[model samples]
Target: MQQQPPTSPDVSSAAKSPLFQSSTQYRNWRFSVEQLKATRAALNQASVAAIRNTFESDSPGSSSDVHFLDANEEHLLVKLYIIKISQLCGHFRFPEEVEATGITYLKRFYLKNTVMDWHPKNVMLTALYLATKTTNHPISLESYTANIPRTNASDVLDLEFLVAQSLAFEFAVWHAHRALWGIWLDIQDLPQAPPHEELQRIHDTAMQHIRTSRLTDVELIYPPSQIALACLSLAHPEIAAFWARSKNADTALEAIESIKRTITRDGDTPSVDVVREIDRHLKICKNPEKVVGSKAYLAKRAREEKEAELKRKKKAENVRKATEQGNPFGEVLVGQANLDDDD
Candidate 1:
């Protein structure tokens, strides 16, 4: 057998674990409080400018009087849709992993994109559809969209690749629910484990908190295991304290406290009215270039197709030059070569 690896003095914190630190979640998706704010604000600003330009170009002075959605409003709208993902999952009888992974994908997509370009309504559906596949919930495309009125297979598929791209194609997510389950199993073997009924209640309550955490920034800020413990701490402080003391994890308890506060502070979804208002503004400010059948979308597609055709023609020219002149890229051969050229 190979030798065991060395660990630090404070090894209880999940964020510091070697396995988790190497995950894409820790490396690519993690962010500080300030960084998350700065990123959203910057993306919102850039999206506003780009959409305004597109509107101006399409219909001069069209967007001059429009009130665009700010970063906070965009976030509220996304939260609204996150809740929708859960409802949809329930409707489809999807597993919690699919729901959670869908939410994570939607969040990651908005980090690198804006709600204006792709409405969260459509993207939420697409993300959940993609999540169903990624999480092994295996619902057919027709079956998935059949019951969702006004949604067709194309509507879900159109943004599927785009969502995948936004997530950097990292579909595997280590979720807090799994961690909480693991912790629950460990709690079973504890010195004075709660009676079966009490332990089950604690597990269920903590699992609810884990679901609530998906509505907050804790998922991006901390590892799943830390979030799980924090949720457990929230559900039943006495049991959490007992578990922590059992493990002699002082620092871990401190971090759990901090994350517990974060979940409590930010976990609740905004009121329906508040989110409804943000969503109302979103329709007016949404990017026309992404709105299918809009003149701007048609124009944008035409331009993209033109550019693609040009690139293809250029490649063909290069191929012809290579075959005829022994050069990868050049004007077509003529003169003596013309005599040998096939009709």
Candidate 2:
């Protein structure tokens, strides 16, 4: 039997409203830790099989010595590209929505597609460009790509549809910053609320935590409000406790701590040395079909062309035989008009 769909990383303690239950994010993208690992491992295995096939077809024994990247290594390279997405957002002065959504898109794309077929560098650029539009921070195609050293409009535009498709066209994202704003407002109206300066400090710190949480899987496994609450918990436990008690402490705290553990455990970026080694191996083992001018690609192309030529010749010969046998489709002789015309 097929494996059961992955459950959420943590069973969310908070309740969901009808509206949230209807959302694509709620219905589609969430995954447990083991599920995510299994998904990546399966994708890596399929890609490695294809890579080996390509090499074996091109020249026997070539793939026997190539070192293929494992699932964890693929993730490290994607992580390196995730950092680059942040720098692109900063350079363009984009809001947090664009940055966060861009990062999410890049991550989700790799979930559906392996990096060996499409490198994250190209996909990251396209994901950010798609993010600018999906988040309502549109930039013209020309202006969007003008600053990059060797990039043009097509470079990003070509991959836009691919990235969107991989995301299942779920462009609406409920970000943590928005949820934090709601909490920030609610905190001020509480009875005997903290001083304005202290509240502001707390919100700022919570915002920092929210940003860090973007690098983790908390967003996928939890809703925005829960993630915001968790960020608040990280920023100041007492304030978070007060806010939770003012609302409903039991359910809120459970979610807050669950998110906290995930954020704290997996929030760090992977080491560059690890990623660099993986990228080096990637060059050697990437699918040859995607590499233009590679031996496998050229051989595959030549075979296709030869097949097309033979098919064309076969079609023409059949037509010639049909005409020679006086089929209705035979060419008309110029000198012999229709027999009926002689009357």
Candidate 3:
């Protein structure tokens, strides 16, 4: 027999490296700082344009109009929705990974489409549904929608495909939870590691920080490993020394500090009244009924639909007329000539 080539490395080790790789190929979810800024800018611009269009159409000469939600307010609305997503995940008894993935999807979806066009309530549920499927924690549409008030299977399922398409089908989310675990193991291997109980405290605190970090833009601007290290630093001051010893200590510390500031700045949850107001707006967007100006909006939409129907009928009539003028291929191709015929 011919001599065999050099044996390849074991499959286990081969898989391990890729699992930890933070490069673009392994971690497509990672984005540059500029990209994050651009996403926010685009969302703001679209929102302003949409609001202006609505105002212009409603009152053509009104020059004293303001945006419905300024940038800060819009950001607050997004945070509130993420909180709602977490609550839903908890109610369903889903794991932390599912919650993180769902929140990630919700954030990503908003980057491309504003709340005006796509209501976050429906998108939140759809994101959770998609997250469950992607993470191998499958839940049926019926079961998922049963507990959600004023929602049904179609509400979630109908938007599932659209959400996936919006994300470009890149569903591989590397959450900070895994990085937290990896850091914990690294500490365990250190020569001067803390006691088991202390280590557990650190781990639990870091996990909590990771959960809170989900409400910020840290996920989009920083890698999961950095986020995990940052959380660990916050949980245990000693971890700062470990980060300081790393090759990219300066950069890593900057990112960690940045994330810490975000966490600190937004530590206080929105008040119940604020949350209720945001929820009311989201509900109105989802179902315009019972809301002010809904009647005018509905009437305008009806007129537009009627106009569209007339245009469609006129196009069909033109096609029919063309096909009847001795054009052998036109009849079959344009007019469904053989659609009703049976061999």
Candidate 4:
């Protein structure tokens, strides 16, 4: 009797959990465009309002002025911080799985708190510490903070619980690495397959794409399987075509397109000027006293202060014109009085 081919396992029962539904349904990890917009807007508004209030309350013509990172600046700073997280993980000799998980934790945490409210450096350290524990590659707090500059055990441990709370203790992160392995295995079983070296190259290239993909919003928008397919598509078009045709070609193609858009949006690579600006701002944010003394910070602050002064003068001029028009509501128009108050 001839041996029979093994049947695929029935995963119907496993489809009932939230993990299975993550690709189709919106989970806590996923964010809509509007949600991202609102979050950034709220952070910017709060920072500006705080700065204005401080300037107004302080003594007249004080040189001290507050500076907050704009949306673009904040985004760049976060990207740099994520890169630092990878470096730190590498220094400790942790596997890529730990690095990916840690970076995801940092990203998700920032979605809840702004860079102003929670410094990215501390959060990055906390996330990595959490990742090491979660991945079963536990490291002592002392050992972890040994080489990291300006950090101690307390810095990591103190924020560890907060980071966990920010993530709602959602430690389970499904990475595209495993999915890439599955695709490689499938390719190996195919007839007329390439030599082992070529197959390894395909696998390596796909892994590289997956690593780069983490620097994008694709992880939040798409599932690991889609990410895996997209990476393979970038690596080997034939493998991607085969994989898509075997599954839902339309859906897979759409996801691949979205990933392509994200990669394009990130651009070929960050320009040197952009990278320098990010570093300058990151240094100021981390060590304001040291960096605020720099000439660049002073020039930037002067420009911002000038803009704020212009806005104030314009507002005053508008109020004066409104009052001269003999409008009873002119005082309220200048935001000086409330019209709703009973006399």
Which lDDT tens digits does candidate 1 get at residues 197-242? 9999999999999989999988888889889889999999877877
| Rank by lDDT (best first) | 1, 2, 3, 4
TM-score of decoy 2? 0.81
> Against the true structure, what is each candidate's TM-score?
0.88, 0.81, 0.74, 0.70
* Candidate 2 per-residue C-alpha lDDT over 1-343 given as tens digits, one digit per residue, 9 for 90 to 100: 8897788765365444556767887888888778888999999999999989988987899999999988888887887888888888889999999999998898889889999888998899999999899999999988878876689887798788889999999988778889899988999998857899988999999998898788777777788888999999899888788888888765888867889998888778888888888888889999898788987778879988899888878866865675576756444532233334311
Model 1 scores a C-alpha lDDT of 0.88
**Per-model lDDT:** 0.88, 0.85, 0.75, 0.73
In model 1, what are the clashing residue pairs, if there are any?
none
Task: Report the error of model 4 at residue 187, Å.
Answer: 2.7
Number of the candidate with higher TM-score, 1 or 3: 1
Model 2: per-residue Cα lDDT at residue 83: 84
Q: Please list the residue runs of candidate 2 whose C-alpha ends up more than 4 Å from where it truly belongs after superposition.
A: 1-16, 298-343
- Backbone clashes in model 4: 0
Q: Kindly list the per-residue Cα lDDT of model 4 for residues 1-343, writing each as its tens digit.
A: 9887885676766766656466322456766556776776777667546544444444344324434567666666677778888788778889988999998898888776666546778889999989988888898888788889888888788788989998888888878887788878877876645899998998898888887887776777777777888888888878777767665575687668777667547624445688677666544343221234654446558878899888878877865787777767655565753343322
